[model samples]
Target: MTVFSVNHVTTYAYAEPVRLGEHRMMLRPRDSNDQRLLEASLAIDPPPKTLRWIHDVFDNCVAVATFSGETRELRVENRITLEHTPFEGDEFLLDDSARFYPFAYDAEETPDLARSIERHSPDPSGELDRWVRHFLHPGRPTETGELLMTLNYAIKEGFYYERRVEKGTQSALETLARRRGSCRDFATLMMEAARALGFAARFVSGYLYVPDCDGENRHLGGGSTHAWLQIYLPGSGWVEFDPTNGIVGNRDLIRVAVAREARQAIPLYGSYFADNATASTMDVEVRVRQSPSCELPSAPHRNL
Candidate 1:
């Protein structure tokens, strides 16, 4: 049976009350089998100064926001419908014998560690060859899937996902030095390493439900948000990688939207008339719910 209900609310009364907005995403008939019915609505008081387009890496729900004058308020709401499936430890098709998206050994990659990253590293992206290499190295996992798996585990093991106040988000190097970071840092390292290897990769942002076992003290915990990575492959398409839990997707995860980077999937973002890009403050809220009749079969399988 679907358990408790969760509602998230965040308010940022800017120094001065500015115009704002409340955009919404109307859940459509999703193409996934695990999802039954999904619906969501967003409202703004006094309406917004302006409503702009906002998207996330997962491209799940298009968040809406409105601006007033000086104190722009940002409100976000997330509603998800899920059909629980028993934890059966589904089958995993891990491929690693060969490269999916191959490219000629080119100098354009990482002139120093193309091979280190491509073969022994993450994806083909040069952005984090050195950083990712510190975690995943030659022949760690024989399969490409295993390579990613190694990285995921490495991140969870090496970093502490505690909420803190830091200036200028850290880079791959900085993250490696600190051995800690948010989803942004984790995804960046993964993307940079993958791209260095020559495979196309991108950053993704969206919502991920923390396991009940962890309660509210989890990474991307309730009201906090979630982050993961996606690597482009040849025959298999894009694959999701979660370093937080060292696990990929089963039914526990929801695939929302995708984009080149997290900025593209901000849920809601827009430039107004002037250069006042201070972004005084921004807030987001999300909720995932499972219905009563939609019981999670004791046995979780595709039945395929």
Candidate 2:
């Protein structure tokens, strides 16, 4: 088991005071068997007049803040400490019936996984279908797990990683054509490809913890938020795949929120109104560090 302390800070600067709209924040990690949240705290500057917590469609904790006055700057800071038990690989062995390619889910499990199995983007040109077809073999049955691992590694090795400051992700075809994209773009491509192959997949937004192994820094997508995908198998359930790093499990993935699409899992969302010529800028910083033997005073269960 490993413990970590994560700090995330976001600041918005405006040329003049502006009216801030309701802001939604998704900064807390969801509790699961493999991970436990010990303590969490959030501080917002130009404090909102009202703040409330709500669970979204995907059951992610979302903070809704409404402000009555205007401010020249807005800042949001979040801190969390948690314990993560590394899930071993052998623990996810598939059932005998699902060990090979082209397996079916039980008749009872189809409806709930329907939305995730369908592609969210337009594939009118059949580009995505053709891309996934490259992994198929006609006569020989492929090991399902091996095929997925190959596809994951192929993305990391075949494409270039580009850090984008844009607000949204690119389409799957757009990323495939350029062979370069941000973490979210790569994850969307992989998720859509898996869905085209009749697998249920979803987008995951979280933090990547890069440890100092051998006193060298060799990991990507660690200094900020990261994106990946999760595919559901019959016996193994939902398994994480980080195509950006060719990682196949939850070893370094500290999940904060999950959704059927990337936009639904944004860490922060809001709008402000200002004069047509008024300008604004945003800055975000995220840091994740190992807290060897540190512990918090209390375990809080409050939301937002």
Number of the predicted model whose TM-score against the real structure is largest: 2
Per-residue lDDT of model 2, residues 1-304, tens digit only: 7888899999999999898999999989999988999999999999899999999999999999999877999999999999987664344678778878888877799999999998899999898899987987878998788778888889999999998987999999999999999999999999999998899999999998876645665567877889999999888889888999888878768999999999999999899987666688988898988777433222221110
lDDT of 1 by residue, 210-248 (tens): 544424434353455455666654334455676765545
What is the total number of backbone clashes in candidate 1?
42
Ten contiguous residues with the weakest lDDT in model 2: 295-304
Q: Could you tell me the lDDT of residue 89 within candidate 2?
A: 39
